[model samples]
Each structure stands twice: as structure tokens, then as C-alpha cells.
Target: MLMVMDEPKPNHWVFFSVAQNSPDFTLTIVFFILPHSEVKMGLKQTIKSLDAFPRAEEHLLQKTQTGALVSVIGLVIMATLFFHELRYYLATYTVHQMSVDLKRGETLPIHINMTFPSLPCDVLSVDAIDMSGKHEVDLDTNIWKLRLNSNGHIIGTEYLSDLVEKEHADHKHDHDKEKDHPHIHGFDQAAEALVKKVKQAIAEGEGCRVYGVLDVQRVAGNFHISVHGLNIFVAQLIFDGSKHVNVSHMIHDLSFGPKYPGIHNPLDGTVRILHDTSGTFKYYIKIVPTEYRYISKDVLPTNQFSVTEYFSPMTNSERAWPAVYFLYDLSPITVTIKEERRSFLHFITRLCAVLGGTFAVTGMLDRWMFRFLEALTKPKRRKETECGSLSGDGCCFGGN
Candidate 1:
């Protein structure tokens, strides 16, 4: 009527609908969570089953002497095979990767130790040039020149740069004296020093040893030592063109960086230049950058290079300077070697497979052998018993 029976309230209707769907919501939740729990339980059961030992009848499990011996031999063989496979796996597990080196114009230090048996220390010069047109002549910095006798024994050693600097200083002092003639107090000390140096060099022996580190651009370039001292007045006066300079050289240590044990440089210990004629020996080298990662987590960055050599003898028409030239080029690709060990889980799985497979196969083979032997002897036994019976004797079939 007028009251409209306090029309069913909105709250009541909402409550009624929720109550009606509550059972369905509970069932849906159970349906979602139940399978997950069941799956987890099933997984646990499977793992347990795999870990459990197999069961068999007592007689089947029993071992005879022959069977036991075969099993032991089979186990030994399986162990040997497993170890071999493991070693192979470990050896083959190498990871290879590459990376870009964006650092350009970097300098690479080339350490060189060389001996020239016939070249005098005073007459030798070091020169370097790159593809970029950068040239370095008489590179004395970080270099050493050792004076050696005809017997290839070191007699004296001096820093190449220091020697050059002293000479330059003497020349400068002489020029300064000329500028200040009034200050001149001695009988040309600079000239006297120069003469002394010349005499000392002349008196020195022929063999020369060069040991130094040259820093060059990472790009292709070459550094060489040559006997250009024929142009020097003092050097010319000392030799008087009497003896041909022997260019035979031994490379003691040539590498891209600090020396490491067991690393071999192809050019190291290389001896060439058996002839005395003026010529050029050129080496074309291709360098590959490598990164080695050991299992101990040590990382080493090194370079390996291959070389191709060429020799050109000087003719009367083109009497060029005798020199050794190294031409090198960098490879864009980098090589990485990493040592890895097998995972414990993987090793265990393989071990299980090997043992189980061997056991099954060997057992089958042993059973077949035993059965064959029994079959072969049974016919002979039967024949023997029949013969005894034919002879009218009381035949005994071994208490059968």
C-alpha cells in the first residue's frame, strides 16, 4: 500500500546475490589450487621413485663366481670409459666469443732483442714507419745498443738515446762557443769530445746487439735496424771500405707485450741475412688478437701473428740500404678461449646412465653365454649315458 512494504532494499538484494554465489566461488578456488598441489605431490613422488633402489627376487640377485668376475670386469671397463668420456667432454667444452675494439690510434709496444754479428754498434740505426705516414728515425728512446766482439760476446752497453743526447749537447756547445767567441777559454773542448767519441767507436768491435721496446700505432707498421754509417765520415774512415758488414742476426725475444712462459714467437730466435750484399728483408705479418680465460678466472689478452718473408738483393743500379722490415696488420675479429667444467648434475646423470646400461647389457650377455654352454654339454652327456646303457652296464646319469 502506501508503505510499499519498505521496498526490498538495495543492500538486501546485494547480500542475497553474494550468498547465492558463495558456494560457486569456493569450488572455483579449490579447483584452481587443488591441481597445483596434486602436481607438486606427483613430482615429489617421481623424484623419490627415481632415487629408490630396485627390488628383485633373491635368486635373481645372487651372483656366481663367473658372474661376479664378469661384473667386476664390466665395472672396471665402464669406469674407464666414463673417465675417458668425461675427459673428452671437458676438453671440448670451449666457449668462443667476439667483441669490438673501438679504441683507435692506440699504441702497441713491440719488445725486441736482436743481435747482428757483423754490424758495428756505432753504424746501426733504428727506423720505424706506419701506413699513416708517421715516421720515426734513429729511435733511441727506450733502446739499448750493446757493443759485442767478433766472438758474439757483449763488451759494453749504453742507452741509445743517452748517446745521441750527449752528441747533440756537444754540438750545441760548439755552436754556443762560436756565438760567444770572447768567452772561449779552452782549446775547443766540444771538438775534442767529438774526436774522442769517434776514436772510441772505431776501436770498438764489429758485432752489435739491440734490445728495446718500440711503441707504434695499432695499425700496420714496421721497425728496422740498418747499417747506414757508411755516410758518416768517422765510420767511413774507420772501416775504409775494407770489410763487408755481415747482417746475420739472431732474434732473442720478439713479442707484442711482456714475456710469458711457454709463449712462442715465430720470429724469435730467427737468424737471417747470410749474405753481405746490400738488400732488404721484409716480413709481412698478420696479427690476431686473442683473449684466454682459464678455469681459475684468469684472463689474458695476447696476440698471435703469422709472418711471410721476402728478400730483395741490392743491384748496382739500385744499391738500397740493407734493412729488416716488419709489416704488420691487425685483424678485426677477436678470438676468445674459455675453460669450463661439467655441471655436477650432468655428471651424475651420465654416471647413472653408464652404470645402468652396462649392468643390463652385461647381465644379458652372461645369461646367454651360460645357456649356450649348458646346451652344448647336455647333448654330450646324453650320448655318454646312452653308450653306457648299450654296453649293458648299470648306467648312472650323475644321480639323475
Candidate 2:
């Protein structure tokens, strides 16, 4: 050591230290890489095992005729049960819900296609009233009043609104000053024309076919067609000789919206006045809004209503106005029914589950049954062989 020892360079010292610890470095590398290599190998082995088909002994694969028949029957039963489960899964469905509409003043159309056998088209007038004190009387627009004969044959068809419009158009220039004044103008002329038409029809003694659509506010309202004239007060006060009008009706088609299959309207039928007394027939209708959604994504908004009827007969002093009244109220809640089918992916997953589960269960049952049968027969065969050997020994001893 006393001999001159030169100082070591930084790079040389670092290289020498690393070389001295080469064994630790090699161990650390092996520690990290070994586990990763083992994991990769294990993953490959697991995949290989999963991909490989199951293997069985030659004796296990062999089957007797009875076993084969039983296996076939079991498979048939399993298939039936699987299909039943599939059908049940498809049939069991859920409905999606939505919020109800609570807004007011929405209008709904009431379609009427009625035939009056005794009420003349002239005197039969349509009127509607709601809880809000709004009244619509003698509706003519969008209404067709067809005159019928005594035998219920169509005599003439008239659109009341059209006649009024035509008369107004004809006298448009002649009554410019009258049109400016609201006292006696277009509406008065229309009313005069309507009265004339009604008088003509009454003179002919014609039956009525009332068919039209009436748009009413979404509230409790009653619309009635009565024999009492538009000027009811004048008729009662001056013309006290007015006779009682019969109200025998045949409702052809009545609904809230366009006709669809399986839709039922309570009033679409033959309604006759059994008693000869003058009265009012009232239908209290409760309407429920419905939305029908098809699998093809077609959505139809419609309404369903239920009705209870009441008839009020006229008293001796009361005026007789034979009419049919529809009083309707709408519900706040709406029902949305959607049609759907099982998806392809869902069906495939269920099919696989059913097939795999059935096969596994049946296979286990079959194996257990085969083992039990073998165990039961083995003792019996062994006893029979023992008895036969004993008999052979007895014969040998006797011969000796």
C-alpha cells in the first residue's frame, strides 16, 4: 500500500461498482421477467384447455338401446321446456310510463252519424252547453241534414252552412250597408234562409239523418238535438199547438277520432224512445286520452269514453223538447301503450343459456341414473354366480 496508488476515475469507479453488483442486477431482471413469462404461459394453457373438446372413455361413450331411447326422450322434453321458457320470456313484457297532461281548453271532435226515424230534419236542431256557460245552438256548419221519407228512404241532402253561404254571397253587394251594421246583417239572412229550408222540410214531413263533426272544448258539455225550434220562447208563447216530436235514433258511427279496429263507441247503436212522453235522453260520458304505439313506430293519439244514460220525462206544465244529449268530461291522465318485440341479441343469449343449461342438467341426471342401475344389478348377478358354483360342487361330490 505504501507503493504509489493512483486515484480511480469516476467512470472507472462506476463501472467497477456495477460489475461488482452484476449478480444482484441479473437477479432483479429474472425476478421481474419470470412472473410475466409464467403468467403468459398460464394464459395460453387456459385458452388451449377452453378451446379443446371434452374427452370421455370408450365405455362411457357406449350406450344400451334402452339408455339411447331414454336419452332421446329426455332431449325431446328438454326442447319442449326450452321453447316454453322462451315463449314465456317473450310474452312477459314491461310498459314504459310518461307524464300526464293537465292543460285545459283543448278541443276534441265529436263525430255524429245518426238517423232519426220520426223527428223531421226541419225541427231537429243541435245545441251544446258547457259548465263555462258557453252555449252553441243550432249548429249548421260541417253538418249534413239529409231529409228522409216515411219509409226511411233518403229524399234530399242539404248542407245547411253551404246554403247560408250561397245566400250571403248572392246578396253580398246588395247589403253592404247592412253588413257594416251588426244589427241585421249576414247572420240574420242566413237564419232566414235556414228557417225557410226547415219549413219546407217540415211541410214535406221528412225524417232526418244528422251526420257531422262538432269541435267542443275539453270540459263537461252536453250536445242535444231537440224538436223544439230555434225560437223556443216564441213557439211556446204564441204557437201553443206544437205537437210532441218522436226521437227514435239509429247511431251509425260516433267516435272521437278516425275509425280504428276494436274501437268501441257506446252510442253507436239503435236507441229508441219506448215511451210516447216527450223527454230528454242524456249520456254522461267520461273520456280518457290514449296513445297507441305500433312496432313500426306509428303513434296514434285517440280517446276512449264510457257512458251512463239518463232519461228525463216532461211534466204536464213543462215544455216538451225531445232530444239526445251527450255530456262529456276529459280525464287528466293519459295512457301510452307501445308495441315491441324481442331483440335478436336477447333471443340468441337466451337460446344459448337454455340449450347449455338443459344439456348439462340432463347429462348429470343420466350419469347418476346409470351408476345407480349398475350398483343395483351388480349384487344380484354376483349372488346368482355364487349359487351356480355351489350347485356344481355338490354334483361333483355326489358323483365321487
Candidate 3:
């Protein structure tokens, strides 16, 4: 059997088929092609059918005053919530975690800025001693001294080496002056005159300001400023007595490590004034190691601390020096702070919740208010009867 279809038109297809063994078997196929515009329209319609939110025609839709008010209120609330969420999304937060400090052979850097209005730069020395018996005497590296006058003004600045060289130059000048004028003064008389001159200069109100960094082992230690570099006899001769040495000082800044965000050093801008008596001012500090991790994954190593202070006055019988001592120890616990931001998915979730909840609540309120207004405006029906005996059926009439 064979079947044949008509000739194909433009944008159309026709096919014919025949079976070899059966005379009654036949097949026919036809395809009509659509224009490109119609194809695109069909595809768009298919996609639109999948939309869950259906829109009603404007002519068929009815609007209510209550609904309009509710929409305005909802819009305001939605905008508020959106801005709030935006702020929360853009903001970064800090998370703190604690762990055991396991680092080995690390050094702690200490920055100090101190002003001693009562101590002169000539006799001031900085010394450090650790629990391991490592002693640093007359620390000179990376240290600076500023000579200040009575008005708290910087008159000169020098390091330990500069001061030593200056002193040697002065001694050579004195020796040459003695050689030139042989009968003027002996070496002993010149030495006495130099001491008297030093005392007079000190009485004219010269102060010292020390500021620098010191690196030490990560262990318990004590650092102090005193007249330890000079012999006891010379120090006593200069100051008249150890009891009269005024250790009054102001600590401008003190920190154990490089500062990061939110690092608070407890001893900054601390002023200790000792009046009329010489004493030792001791600050006992406990240091906590800290690590700050930025959002960019940069890590900053730092430290934070708290301190306690004690003052021990010198007794007449006690043979000791007046100084300012900073005693510090380390904590085994390490604190880590990290900066983080809210995730995008979290922001999306909050936005959805805000929109959906506001829509549902406002919709319910609008509906209830509309129904209430409708009930109030609706006319009530009344029944009335005018009866007269006329026939077997009763006469009744009523209209509302």
C-alpha cells in the first residue's frame, strides 16, 4: 500500500509512506512552520505561564481607600526594614576567641615615653632585669633623652654616646685651660668648681624626657630608671642625699607590642608625683597576647595588659635608690580577634522575611478594615405590613 500527500506550500512540509507487505498500511505526516515573530511570542507565553504571581486587568480590579493607606504604610515599613538590613549587611563585626599561647622564643617589644620633671638627663639611666637573671645596664640602643627646662620645653636631645663624648670634651677643655693658666686653679680646685657648676645648673630646673622602644624576652621582667650608672658616693654628692631625690615622673605612653584596633594600654598618660620624699614607684602589669585577623586575612600580633601600682618610700636606715620600676609578666592565654561581615544569603533571608511578613500583615489589616466599612455603609432592610380583611388570602405588602 502507498499513500501520497499534496505538494508542500511555503514554510510547510508533507510526507508519504508505504508498507511493502500489507496493502492497507499507509502513513502520512505534515508540519506547518510558524514565522520567527510567532515563535518568539509562543516561547514568551510559555515562560509567562510559569509565573506564580498573576496580574488582574486594571479595568477589572477595584481599589479601596483602606487598601491604599495600608499600601503606603507597608511601603514605609518595608523601606525602613530594608535600610536596617542594609546597615547590618554592610557592617563588620569582631569575634573574640581564646586559646593557649604556644609560641616559643619570641621577643616582646616595649614602647615607653616618660617625662621626669624632677630628674635631670645627666644622672638618669634605664636598666632592665629579667627573671632569668639577664640584666641590661644603661640601655643605650634605640633610646633617646630630651633635656627639658622648667617651662617643660625641649632644650636639647642626645643619646648616651653623645652625652659621654660631650662630657669628655668638657674635661679636655678644662685640662687645656689649666695648662694655659698654671697658677689660676689646680686640677682639684677645677674638679670642685665643675661639681659646683653642675649643682647650680640642676637647681636652675632642667628636666629629662625619655622615649623609645625596648625588646626583651617573652617572660617576667622588671625595668627601672634610676642613678644605677653612677657610683653611690657621686650620686649622694650630687643630690645631697638619696632621700632628696625626687622620682616624680609622668608616663606618656607604655605598650608591650605594636598596637592594633581596639588595643588599650592601661598606663598611658599616667602621672606620679612624689613630694618632699624619695620613693620607688612600681607598676605591676600582666600582659595578654593578642592576634588581630583582618577580613583580608592579614594577621597582626599584639598585646594588651592591666596594671597595679605600689609606692615604697625610702627609710633612713635602708640603703637603696629611688626609681620608677615597671614589673611585667605574661599570661598563657592568647586572644584572637577577627573582623567579619554578614553573608549574602543571610541578607537575602532577612529581606524575604521582611517583605513577606509586612505584606501578609498589611493585607489582613486592609481586608478587615474594608469589611468593617462595608458593613457600616450597607442599608438595613425593614419589614412592614398593611392588613385588611378582603378575601380568603391575606393582603401584605413590604418594601425596603
The candidate maximizing lDDT is 3
Stretches off by above 4 angstroms in model 1 are: 1-66, 85-93, 117-123, 132-141, 144-209, 229-243, 258-269, 273-278, 289-299, 332-342, 349-361, 368-400
Q: Give the TM-score of candidate 1.
A: 0.59
Clashing residue pairs in candidate 3 (N, C-alpha, C atoms within 3 angstroms)? none
TM, every model? 0.59, 0.52, 0.64
- Model 3 gets an lDDT of 0.77
Q: After superposition, how far is residue 222 of candidate 1 from its true place, in Å?
A: 1.7
TM-score of 3: 0.64
Q: How are the candidates ranked when ordered by lDDT, highest leading?
A: 3, 1, 2
* Span of ten consecutive residues with least summed lDDT in model 1: 165-174
Backbone clashes under 3 angstroms, per model: 0, 0, 0
> Which runs of model 3 end up more than 4 angstroms from their true locations?
1-84, 135-140, 161-202, 353-400
Can you write out model 2's per-residue Cα lDDT over 1-400, one digit (the tens) per residue? 1334356433332112222345455421111122455666877999888875778888787686657766787789778977876786576343545558665656777888998876666666666566665434433347789989877799888774432211212211122333465364334565667656655555565688989887776776666676533444323322232335457687887787664445678778856644455666778888878777766678877777788988777555543445687788877878676767778688777777877887787777777878888899999998777767887566534643
Q: Candidate 1 on 243-303: residue-level lDDT in tens?
A: 3344568889878765433456799878885754656678888877777777888888777
Which pairs of residues collide in model 1?
none
